[model samples]
Target chain A: MRNLIDILDLTTSEIDELVAVANDIIESPQKYAHKCAGKKLATLFFEPSTRTRLSFEAAMYELGGNVLGFSEAQSSSSAKGESVADTVKVVGYYADIIAMRHPKEGAPLVASMNAGIPVINAGDGGHNHPTQTLTDLLTINREKGRFDNLTVGFCGDLKFGRTVHSLIGALSRYKNVKFVLISPKELTLPEYIIKEVIEKNNIEFVETTNLEEVMGQLDILYMTRVQRERFFNEQDYIRLKDSYILTPEKLENAKEDMCILHPLPRVNEIAVAVDNDKRAKYFEQAKNGKYIRMALILKLLEVE
Target chain B: MTISPIENGIVLDHITAGKGMELYKALGLAELDCLVAVINNAYSIKMPGGRKDIIKIDAEIELNLDIIGYFDPGITVNVIKNGVNTKLPKIDPPKEIKNLIKCKNPRCITSVEQELPHIFKLTDSENKVYRCIYCESKAK
Candidate 1:
């Protein structure tokens, strides 16, 4: 009956529980391997994805469940003019749960409404990715050991970064969390998000074009890609692409304990040399994505 | 000149002037074969500049109050039965609306999946803001 359409769909307590379970899974991987012995997971990705789709597959496989469905829309019945509701209804018969990623923002929501089984939104356009938010939460928990009283700096593509928006939504639920939004004016966080989540929640936040000025104050630095696909003109994309590249020189000003995070497949936004830094937790964050997804699948399936 | 009072139908009163046609279209009034009266720029004692819109449907038809509230929450509804004003239902806008206002975001899934219904949820009641449930685009 439950679906992971948005990060807010899960309560703070539920998120904490997911993190707790994820931590346990990390510590004792074998103990919970075959929890969903006979369950099936359908990954209905309408768009091509490497990490998000694979993470879901790996999570389900580790849970002793089988995976089905398509990696692209062309491969699915969608190419034959099948509606999302119809596709979901048909898929619900074959799978115990569904993880769908679509180019359209609310396609998963449409599926969730019609699906008989629990639906997990792997990624829905740039609208929401709750599982990624959970993964980010787990990364923060593991790296920093706490959530409250932390200054999180969101750099680059704050406007179009769904992960940034999602993480900000999640982090705002905690106490004493301040946001340092670093981006060009064109890519600044959307006004509705500002009015709805930040200002409405009374969370302290500062907006600036300079990432270096606010680098030292941050406990968590969340980086996002300024997508080339989002731009109509190549000149604008090229001009603003290198605006906030996090290099060793920039990292020098940040706190030693400051955790660097990114929803990966990052382009030149992050310097290759900075990957060696202990603070860069994106790879580990990617790995943690599987565990949290495992925790999510198990929780949704109600498999003990 | 005063318009004749309705006897056995729903009276939608106090709609903002120049918005009655929109409400009529939204409510699919064009499909209605029954007698329907729309008084545009009607005199209003309470409103500033004494202007409002009044719709008198001369039949007892099922109306979705939530949709009415969303279209124009300031409007008042009066249910008339057998030449009598029977009840005035509370017109609070719904928190969640399914298959209604579409998400305006170009990147929204509904845009591609043309068969999908446009869904919205009332995110900010004070601001009277309804956002696309899919992409969270604020309704215009």
Candidate 2:
């Protein structure tokens, strides 16, 4: 009956359990191959996405589940003006679970309310991406072997980056976690996030325009692309697009073990030259998304 | 400068000074043919600096108490019967608001569908922040 709409919907213990299950799936892929046998996953992607959609489809296939639904609104009855609430109610009858990615934030939330089955928000505008948060958690847990006492640096856009907001909210639950927010003045972390998550939670955090100065201090460098889609003004996006481009030269000051992550479909934010670097783990992070999603599908389906 | 009391109607007392007109508009007092007196700045001991807004409507219309409460907690609704305050209904703040305020998020489905109700869930009551249930956008 529960849906993964926001990262905060999952508690600390629940998140740990999910991470544990994800690790288990990674350890023994064959054991969970048929865990979701005969179940159906309706991926109602109203927006164009490659990684998130593929990850869900691939995860379901690995779990021995069937996949259904449209890739975009144009392909579905939505193009003819069928409402999301009505569409989900009908789809809920066909699918055991739904993984939806909509350009409009809260579309999945409306589905969760109307649908008979569990609804997963793959990505919702710039609001929240819980599954990505789960993927990030699994990646962090595997790479660092811990969440507590880590200096996490978030580079580039934080104001409109839902991943940064979700990850910061997730990590704030752990102990001794300090955040180093690196972005231009326009793209700096929102004051609401600073007030609600950082100040209210009493988590230590510092804001800066420089990423290199604090590179050595971080255990994890969470990189974010300046999202052109989230911005209302193309000029503003163009002006701030190259705010932080992670090159090998930028890694000179970073610690040897500091892992870098991006919810991919990355632009020029992270240089291709850094891909070979031992510290770069964004691709690995993307791969982890499938495993975590597999675990999430299992949890929501009660296949575990 | 006292407005005459109504014999059989409702009186909204102790609204936050500048917010009376907003509530008035939200409650749709425009279409009503009844005598609606809006006191934009009225003296009250309860409010800070002894100033508040009051609304007196000469009709027994059902009030959207939840919206009123969510809009401003200090507002009290008094029902007058036979020139006396016969009842004081408690306005419980609505935990979830549906279609009252539009989700301003351009990327919200509510913005596109146009037919979908603008739903908001009260996330933080103490800070009085309501988030759009659909897009998670904070209510302005």
Candidate 3:
């Protein structure tokens, strides 16, 4: 009866259970190697994404499950004008479970309605990415020891970053979490998020243009890319691109134990100089992505 | 007061007066050259406290005939042939519907530029929104 479409769908206890399962998998990888043996995971990436698609495939393979599905719409019946509903009806017959990534905002929810098996939304168009939020949760729990009473700084494109929105939605459920939002004025978090999620819950959060000023106070500095394409004026991007960068000089002011995380394929928002720093856990975060996905696949299929 | 009859027409009667105008606008009938006989505030009766407004539309647009049942099933349709009224029995919404309208979410797969059929189930007719049974996205 459960589908992993959005972070809010998972209760705090369920999140804790998933993180516990992921941690267990990390410790004893061999025991759960075949948790999904003889099962099929259909990765229906309607839009092309090399990173997320490959991660889902790797997760299924590591769980001893076979992966089948298209990486692009052109490669599937979508090219032949088949509808999402009919596609799910057909794909459900073949795969035990489905992991879908679509350019459309609500395609996965559509698929879930008709799919007899569970559906996982890998990513939807500026909508949500719940599994990534799970990965972040696991990483924070392991590193920081708890979700409550922590000050987390979110940097770069907070406006359109579905990950940030999902993470905030998930984190708001916890107790005493403070947010330090660092972004260009243009890329500030959307009002629906501010009114509907943040301020509505009375979670203490402050917006700032200066990243270094708040570096020392953060428990986790979540970095997101500031793409040139998201900018209307080139000069505005030029002025703000360096505003959110996490460099060695920047980390000098940051607490030595402060964790730096990024949903990968990151541009220069976090400088290469900071990669060697002990606090940089983005690559580790990427690896954790696979394990958490393994946990999600097993949980959704009710395999173990 | 009664208006002159057309040689052949369909009369939608007992529509809650103002609602006939809404149905007329929804069907874009104002620009048409067809004879539209709108009799508003022409009927009144004591129902405990006060009376109600009612109107009639005399035309043969079959789609509009179907729409009358959709908008307000209380209205009755009578096919008038040279002033002879032949009452057509009422119709109601189907118990089960496969698809209704395309979802409004731009990123919804239904909005994608493909020949795929867009389908929706009426979730809330009052709000005029449909819940895409696939995406679960509310489309207005």
Best by TM-score: 1
Fraction of the reference Cα-Cα interface contacts (below 8 Å) that each candidate reproduces: 0.95, 1.00, 0.71
lDDT of 2 at B18: 81
User: Which residue runs of candidate 1 sit more than 4 Å off their true CA positions?
Assistant: A228-240, B32-34, B80-90, B98-100
Question: By TM-score, highest first, what's the ranking?
Answer: 1, 2, 3
Q: List the residue pairs that clash in candidate 1.
A: A104-B109, A105-B109
- Clash tally, candidates in order: 2, 1, 7
Compared with the true structure, what per-residue lDDT tens digits does model 1 show for residues A152-247? 999999988889999999999989999999997778999978988999899999999888899999999999877777777888888877778898
> What is the TM-score of each predicted model, taking all chains together?
0.93, 0.91, 0.76
User: What tens-digit string does per-residue lDDT give for candidate 2 at B22-42?
Assistant: 999999998899999999878
lDDT tens digits, residue span A1-304, model 2: 7899998899999889999998999999999999999999999999889999999999999999999988988999889989999999999899999999988878888889899899999898878899999999999999999989999999988888889999999999999999999987778899988988888889999999888888899999999886667677889877766658899998998899999999888888899999999988999999999999999999999886
Residue A159 lDDT (model 2) = 89
- How do the residues A1-304 of candidate 3 rate in per-residue lDDT, one tens digit apiece? 6788888888899889888898998999999888899999999998888767888899999999999999998998988977777898999999999999988877788788888889999998888888889989999998998999999999999998989999999999888999999999999998767866798789999999999899999999999998889999999988888888778988888887999999888877878988899999999988888888998888888886
Q: Model 2, retained fraction of real contacts?
A: 1.00
Q: What's every prediction's RMSD, in angstroms?
A: 2.2, 2.9, 7.0
lDDT of 1 at A100: 96
lDDT of 2 at A79: 93
Worst 10 residues of 3 chain A by lDDT: A191-200
Clashing pairs in 3: A104-B107, A105-B107, A109-B134, A109-B135, A110-B134, A110-B135, B10-B59
